[model samples]
Target: MVTKKAPSAQTAVDVALAELVEGERRWAAIPLSGRRALLDQVRALTGRHAQRWVDAAAGIKGLAPSSPLIGEEWLSGPYVFAAGLGALSATLEVLERGESPLDKARFGRAGDRVTVDVLPTSPFDMLLLNGFSAEVWLRRGVSPAAAKANAGLAQREPSRTNGVGAVLGAGNITSIAPLDVLYELIAHNRVVALKLNPITDPLLPVLADILAPLVEVGAVRLLTGGAEVGGYLVEHNSVDHVHMTGSARTHDAIVWGTGATAAERKLAGTPKLTKPVTSELGGVSPTIVLPGQWSAADIAFQAEHVATQRLHNGGYNCVAAQAVIVAADWAQKDEFLAALRAALAQAPARHAYYPGSDDRVAQAAEAYPRAERLGPTGERLLITGITPSPAEPLLAEESFAPVLGVVELPGTGAEFTAAAATTANEAFAGTLGVNIIAAPATITELGSAFDELVENLRYGTVAINAWTGVGYLTPTAAWGAYPGHTIADVQSGIGVVHNAWLIDRVERTVVRGPFRPAPRALLHGEFALSPKPPWFVGNKTAANTGRLLAGFGADPGWLRLPAIFASALRG
Candidate 1:
């Protein structure tokens, strides 16, 4: 057996700091046009090596090398990176013409705040990502005019640049680490030295290939490391800022300390690393199933929608629906549950890929001994209860495994929606993601009432008839918690990422999709959906669908739609 150890963080920092400072200087000095050119190169490289990138990520995660399910690695991986490149390039292009990227985007008024429509920006995206649209609700008092001036702070205020940032890559997602680094480069004008997660560090070399153009220009550096390397990088004087995608526990230890006295220090507002820190931490996300006149087909579509949201990535997702809230008095509660159970029961066995996932699964199983084992291999589990108190493990903690707990509450229409919103806000520990599943008729009946319902939810990203992960992938949607969390109680951690539009201080992003794309995209498996969704693991055509989607996103055209639909039809 052989072993590889990360270099001493101190030594790594010593070697890189001088060069990083110079890189940061050069990064800032580069004009908007130059930045656009840099991103153009990144986009080309990402598309050029898309398959190889997906292959490397899928292999590491133990997915079948050619399995359509590996489409997760493709869409969430290279597709996201390539999409970010295009979006960031457009943002810089706006700046080159002395315009605010925020102003360049379309906006509308949502209550007191201004909402910028972030996605489906062109006829191309509309033709491609049909049935999906996203908008970022700016923080209150941020008028559309103010939004333009406040956007792209780094370019507007050059003095605010933090020279070099250390991005601690997350093991779970292939694209997150690279995309996080790109934000520091594009938004803050900071050169980055990214320390890849030990769990997925091997993918670093492959990512390096996609990001070679940026690395060549000294915009990014890739490093391999474990806790020691991460600790060193965060504490090193040379590293001016840090960001992460992990647990609040990790963020605390880094921002506070590791000793027995860590908790007291955290309470006292004492110090550890003084450098500015930002993170995308995990949370116990919830989905509220609003009562509707759902037909049998609609019930089944939503069942898979809820189950697939949970089971995606083998349930090791921050946005995974760990908690489900349903109206107890609804006529179709049992029907929905039966459909959901049927979907979960048919789950294909997946490797509990993340470290410590088995223990977490066992813990959830122990907490709810009555929980059903959904898969033959026992990789998936379901915990059912009638609104367990907020203190229950199912509600308080992130399962981070294939365990979903359902809690039922009383109500029908407005009453049900209100109670569901309250439950998701107070009962769930995270403010990361939430889904509101309701029919268009129900919404139309609610009319003006629906807007308030959307406003009431505190989660960072709210999705209607879709997964909050939609907001995560949309380059315009700010991905993080619903604002106003300090380092002390950092629920879903702090800050936002994947916001390539260069807007700032986002409150939340709203993404809405048809319950089913066209008639039976999720029901009879027929759809008008373009760039067919990759989240459906059972779709036999998922791999081809993913490849076609990646192609369409990179180069949207009328010529490509026929082929994309052909592949989508095969599923």
Candidate 2:
């Protein structure tokens, strides 16, 4: 096996800290307008290099050039970043004015606003926009107080004690490192030294070039390496706040040192001294399919829904629906499973990106000896009859593969909802996103129960009808659920990512899409063969829409309606 190696600790720390100081100094001197201009440059450059970026990422992931995953990575991925730019542009405008609509608030005295700015569009925007909204709502509606806090954080000098941030990036997603750095720099007004996970080190230079504006502003710096490099950066003296999007084990090792040190901390009831750290770790997200409400079409639509969530990016996502909790007594249970099996069987087995994934599947099989295997890669879409043992690894652990285990419960809508909620709350993982699929009438009838169930879910984001992954792509939806967690209990993660406007957040977001099929949609089965046909809503279409939406976003007038209809019709 060829294990990717990280940079030496001494070199990693020296380069990282030096870059940090330089970035902080440069960022402090740059005006907000200059920052916005730089961001505009990035947006322009991203458009120019869109194809190259998509191709490079697809190549690394071993995806076919014409694969739907390519379109997804290209269209959905970059589009999310573009939306981030729009949000950041709006935010910068507020910062430049030194006073926003937030100043008229009844509570909290407004201070002389300092203008701190960083790169605008990137995946971080998706994290920030959602995080801000969730945080605002958690604090009880959209209050000017939270907005002011966000603005205040943005304006603070990066060299300040609370302003230096260390971001440890994940290997799977090419955009994760940049997004992580962007969030800390733009949202929190922090100078960032990002440590790249070794798995994706080959893309570091390309990522660096793409994020050059932030690097030029000294707001962001990229460091590459493995365990030692990560440890050195996280434990560095200058680093005040830290964030990571990786495994729970990595988090624990960082928060409470490994081996004897970890044991000592556990026994002492207090961790060894450390600065604040936040993360968005992995999870075994669950999707609950309500009984009796779904028709055969509904079952098929939802089967694809769950399949897309699980198969997207080869099931490496933290929010990938890992478990399906359904009503055992539902008349259509078997039919639904059969359809799901067929749908999954059709999906080409993805490259098992993470190491030891096969072993994880083996472990799951050991727990559920009767698990059904699927696909040519031994990538079993395991179906487990509800097992009596809660200690079973299939039920307790995150398999992090294409494998899914089904647990059945006896109930209709309300009963199933309650049971699913209980299962989600009691699950060992802290970071989770629950998805519930039911008919419109069923939703209306059991609105309160559904709401209660959603509220009771411990996961960060609860998606209804749509895939929870949609929440990650939508700038308006928050990503991570658990906050204030260090690498120690990084169940899902500590803080939010992809939020563009950098609002303090609480709770997960609920993404709701249309229940039935849309005839003209790219995601429809009819369009599956060519989801990214020339007219689809992707990078190229995005450029066309950007020109149209700029006018619409600035002024929503009926004059733009024709263009909007044209775009929709073309798709």
Candidate 3:
């Protein structure tokens, strides 16, 4: 019997890059219709393998098949990915008809910036996500005509060719890698060589099957290995551009080589890697709870929302809420904190699956020794009475774990909003995303000042009455750090992805949802039918709802609506 050695990581990377380089021009020159067809194939394959994908992810995260937490895998994996592909497919359809996707989109002005309504693009979006709204705010000086002309610039001249690009897949979220691949293929017009993070190696088989259509066409090549493979692909001669969804530490090491010379290279503005790079590096995201005359129900609901923001995916998310800002003088502050503690305590226990999560949590504990340990296994940590100062460790670092911190500020209305905004801007380590939770009456009271504050907030996505994860999942909304970081300082990285409409010069994506769910919203005089979002960690019917939603997303049809609604209403 002859024994064959496994192909080495370097050799595998070489083969993948070679394939992508060969297909680079072909992929870029393919017509929009052909691209859309490929997406259809991917969506179909994803639907077929959806269950296996979620199962594998759940197993990795220590979630049993029967665990409601399995719903997280389903929603973050096949469901959101299918939705993203569907969104991209729709954009390609419009492009094929010789029209910009934004031609019929609603446009408005936020301050001096032009804003295009991205959500509610279809009747289904309006019906299913009734009160949720999102807008892509263009950079200042971008006229409406300019925004229209810039949308889907790559697709307009379908035969134009860009070179091969490298995508460094994120490990935490199953959908992130696939969505990044889609973005590179459709929005950037690049054939991709994707290197899976070692931590997500278990997903190799599932992703290969889901992205089989692209792999077959040579438009994409998915490889798996450690940092050696990633370094090889990014530095390869054939790769023209690079995109990554990871940490600032990783981004810095990639751009400026590590060790003794790293600081020197940074200060001298000399990156070891010369290729143009884009990244979605997360920072210490904040949840600003604006003071409102919140009722008992309001406090409880919003507390759960805050908990969901911090505990989703076991808080391994780049945009997870780390610092929660609330008015110290607000009468309901103590009540809200008590409710949040209860929510955290009641949350299902989850293993710390991510590498270094235990160390990170330990570091937080060291920084705040008095931090409360919540969760069934005491896996969740909460540090309260955080002063709004840059010296605070939570304010300076991104704790990508089930750790939450509360920062207290003085004043109310615009006064509190301004202070909270200032702390969020100056203290947070990154600019990836932020969340603002405000009651309807409070927003109405603040009015134009509120709008101005939102406009001025320097983050990639500003989520109102919703977690920043909502913006991340919304394909139309641009996802990245606030524009203006360089490779040296690389805060939250740079550039945007998952922008289905392909709008150029994006400043930020502002997403807003109802302050409360249905029945409660009605009681608060807000007209929205949305129930507890399936992504909520405490959502009891999430497993069923997420499954139905995944099917609908993959193969959208009117027939699927009732089942989804039935499951969601119970949650």
lDDT of 3 at 530: 96
lDDT of 3 by residue, 1-571 (tens): 9999989988988888888877876776677888899999999999999998998898788887888888888888998899889888898899889888889989999989999999888888987898999999999999989988879967777677678889999989989988998888888788888888887888899999999989988899988888877888899888899999999999989999898798889888889999999999999999999998988888998999999999999999999999899999998899999999999999888888999898888899898999999988777899998877778888887889999999998898888988888989988889989999999999999998798779778999999998888888788889999999989888898899989888999999999999999978987699999999989999998998889888988999999999999988998
User: What TM-score would you give candidate 3 relative to the actual structure?
Assistant: 0.98
Model 2 Cα lDDT, one tens digit per residue, 397-443: 66677788777877787888898788766754555577877766777
Ranking 2 against 3 by lDDT, winner:
3
TM-score, one value per model: 0.95, 0.82, 0.98
* C-alpha RMSD of each candidate structure in angstroms: 2.9, 7.3, 1.1
Candidate with best TM-score: 3
RMSD of 1: 2.9
Error of 3 at 443 (Å): 0.9
Tell me the lDDT of model 2 at 84.
57
The better-scoring model by TM-score among 2 and 3 is 3
lDDT of each: 0.80, 0.63, 0.89
**Cand. 2 TM to true fold:** 0.82
Candidate 2's C-alpha runs over 4 A off are 1-9, 99-136, 140-152, 156-163, 269-273, 388-390, 483-488, 520-571
lDDT of 1 by residue, 234-277 (tens): 78877878999988788888888888688788778876777788
In angstroms, the error of model 3 at 436 is 0.9
